[model samples]
Target: MPSETKNDRIFPVSPEKNDTQNIELDLLLQAVFLKYGYDFRNYSKAHLKRRINQRLNISNLETISELQNKILWDKEFFRLFLKDLSINVTEMFRDPDFYAAFREKVVSVLKTYAHIKVWHAGCATGEEVYSLAIILKEENLLARTQIYATDINKSVLETAKQGIYSKKEMELYERNYKEAGGKGELSNYYTSKYGSVLFDKSLSKNIVFADHNLVTDGVFAEVHLIFCRNVLIYFDKLLQNKVLGLFSDSLAKRGFLCLGTKESLKFTDYENKFQAVDKKMRIYKKLYIPK
Candidate 1:
C-alpha cells in the first residue's frame, strides 16, 4: 500500500528560516575568528543576538544570511560590529559603594602581602584599572604591585592603554570618587586638556593591557586578586561557570575574587572553592584546601 500525505502536512521550509540564525551566527562567528582571531562563540546567545540584530539593521538586512553575506564580503562591517558586540559600558569608580567596601575590606587583607598581582578582567576603557592603580598607590602598594587589564575588544583595549577619557565624564567620575571615600579632590587624578582628560601617567605605568578571552584562552598570569565586574551578567550559566573555573584556577592560593554587585558565585560550581570574604559585595577569598 502507498501512503498519501496532505499538501499541508509538508515540512514547509525556507532556506532562510530565522531559527537557522543559530547556524548562520555560527558561520559568522567562525568567519570572524578566522579573519580577526577574536573568538566570541562562547558568549551567551542573548548578547550575540542583540549585537547581530543591531548589525543586521545597520546593514539593512532582514535575515542572518544577508548579514553573513555582508560580513564576509566587507571587513569594515565587522569592525563596526565588533565595537557594538563587546560590552564597553564603563566609567571611573562606577560603583562607589563597591570601592568603599573594598577599601574597608580587601585592602586590609592585601596590606599583609609583600606584593600584589591584580587582574582586571574586561577592563573597558581602563577606568577601573586606573581606579585600582590609584587605590593601590594611596595604600603604598602600587610600587609593589602588577596589574593586568584585559578585554576582548581591541579598540577599547587601545583606549584603555591610552588612558584618555572625555573630560565631560569627570563630574560623574568625581562624584563617584568622593562617594567611594576619596581622600582628596577628584580633580587631582587627572589634568583636563581641551575637552578630554589625560590621566596621570604614573597611574597606568604598571598596568599591562592585553587581549584575553574569558573563553578559549588560557590564563596569562598568576594573580592575587581578580576583579571581573559586570562581565558575567551577559554570559550564560555554562560560560559563566567556565570563566569562574578559569579565574579560580588562575588565582594564587588564597587569592581574592571581586565580582560585580549583580553577579555572584553562589550558583556556580566553584562555590565551594572560595569562601565569602564580603557577602554583600561578592568579594571572595580563595579557601585554603590541600590539593
Candidate 2:
C-alpha cells in the first residue's frame, strides 16, 4: 500500500485501505450519533476526511479506528473533535456584496412588517448576526426585529453570545462594514480594551443565542428571513435537501432566504419554491404555492 503525507502525517493510500477507512468512518459517525447525539453521518465525505485527518495529525493517531476509540471513551476528546468538525469560520459583514444586497432588496420588504423574526441558522461566533443587527439598527428596524442565532456547537455559541472578538480582525471587519453600506463608523459600535473589542451589548439586546441542530432539530419558529450562509456546502446533497425542506417549512409566506455564494437551490427539491431576489448574492424569497 502507498502512503500519502498530509499535514506532516503519513496516511496509507490504497483502494482496499480506502474502502476500510470508509467503513470505519461510517461506524465512527454512528458511534458519535449514538453516544453524543451529534449527527455528522450525512456530512460531506471530503470534508469529514479532511477534518478527521487533521485531528489524526493533531492527536498523533494513525488511523480512524484509534480516533474512534478515543472519541467513544473520552468525552473531552470528543468535544475537541466536535470543534474541529463545526464550521466556525466566519467574519463580520462577510461577503459585503451580500449584505449590500440585503440592505437594498430585503430591508425594504422587512420594513413593511410590523415585527420581523430572523433565523440566522449556523451563526457561528455571531459576527454576521451582529452585522445584520447593525444594518437593521441603521434602517431603524432593530427594535422591531427578533433575531434567533443558533448553532450546533455550544462552544462557538458562547463566543457569539459574548460579542467579543480579537482586535486584529477589526480592519477587515471595518472594510466589510463599509462595503456593506454601513451608515456610520464600525468602531463606533464597539469599544477596544486589552487587544479585544467587545461589541455593543445593545446590538445583542434583540438577539437570542440558542442551541439548534439543523440536521436533527425541527422548525422552532415561523421566520421572515433565514440567513444560513456557507453551511449547506459542508453537507451532502441529501442533507442539504433535508435542511432546505426544514427552511421551507419554517419560513413564512414570501419570506427571504440567504445562502452563501457557493450554495444555491438550483437543483434542490425546493428550487421552484423560492424565487431569487438577488441571484448574484444567492438571496431568494419563498414563493407561496397553493396546493
Candidate 3:
C-alpha cells in the first residue's frame, strides 16, 4: 500500500479481510460489465486492483465497495473510473525496431497485393496508425492500403481521428521515425501551430477510426496485418488467448500480426496458427493451417 514501491501485493490485510476484498473487486467488475457492457472481468487482477486502488486513494474511499457504489449512481464518476481502467499508453513508432522490421519484412509481401487492409487493434490515440501511414506513404503503398484503427475507448478514437498531438512530443517521435527507417522528413506530414501539431488530413483519407472492444466485441474485419502492440500485457492469459483467437479468425491467410515486445503466442491455443516472422520483434504470420 506504500507509494513508489513495486509491490505485487494488491493490498495487505488479514486472510479473512483479503478474501472479502477479492469478492468486492469481483462484484464491482461484474456490475460494470452488466451495466456498461464493457467487460473487464478477465483483465489481470493485479492491474485492475492497482488502478482501482489509485482511484480509491484519489476519491478518499476506504474500500472497493465504496467505489462500486459511486460507480453505480454517479455517471460522471463512472466515466472517470472507466477511463482509468482502460489502458491508453502509446507512442508513434513505439518500438522503432518493430517498425524497422515491418519495413524490411512485411512491406515486400504487401507489395505483392494490389490492395491491403490493415487492422490496428487497440490503437490508442492513433500515434502508431499515423506512423504506419507515413511508412506506407514513403513506400508508395498508402494509396492502396486501408487502415482500420480501433480502440475500446471512444474518446481516444476521436483523438486518433483528429490526428493532433502536442508539439513538445514531436522531438521524440521524430527520433523514433528515423530509427524506424523513415524515408523522408517527418515534419512534412504535419503543420505546427499554437503549441500543437495537426497532421495532414490526407494521412487518414484511407484510414477508418472506430470504437471496437476486443473483450466483448466480435471479429470486426478481415485484414492483412494486425498491429496490437503493448496491449496484451495488461490482459490475463485467458483474455490474451481469447483475443488471439479473434485475431486468428479475422486475419487473411499468411497475413501478419504484430504484438508488443512483451506479448507472444508461444503457450496460447493459437500458437500453431501463427508462424514467428520476428521472434524478437514479436511479429507473426498467420499460417494457412496449423503447423
What tens-digit string does per-residue lDDT give for candidate 2 at 67-92?
A: 99999999999999999999999999
What lDDT is reached at residue 90 by model 1?
89
lDDT of 3 at 123: 93
**Pairs in steric clash, model 3:** none
Give per-model TM-scores: 0.89, 0.96, 0.94
lDDT at position 270, candidate 3: 83
Residue range 1-291, candidate 3, lDDT tens digits: 557553323454467866888899999999998888889999998889789877877777878999999999898898899889887888888999999999999999999999999999999899999999999999999999999999998888999999999999999999999999998878999999999999999899999999899999998789999999888888888999999999999999899999998888986888888899999999999989755
> Across residues 1-291, which tens digit of lDDT does each residue of candidate 1 receive?
544443221221354565677787888888888877777777877778777776665566767777767767788877887787888888888889989989989998889999899999999888999988888888888988999999988889999998889998999999998998888877787888999999898888889899888877888888999999999988878888999989988899999999998889877898899998888888899988996
Model 1 C-alpha lDDT versus the unseen true structure: 0.84
Q: Specify the highest-lDDT model's number.
A: 2
Best-to-worst TM-score order:
2, 3, 1
Q: What is the lDDT of candidate 3?
A: 0.90
Candidate 1 has a TM-score of 0.89
Error of 1 at 89 (Å): 0.2
Candidate numbers sorted by lDDT from highest down: 2, 3, 1
- Which residue pairs in candidate 1 collide? none
Q: What is the lDDT of residue 131 in candidate 3?
A: 95
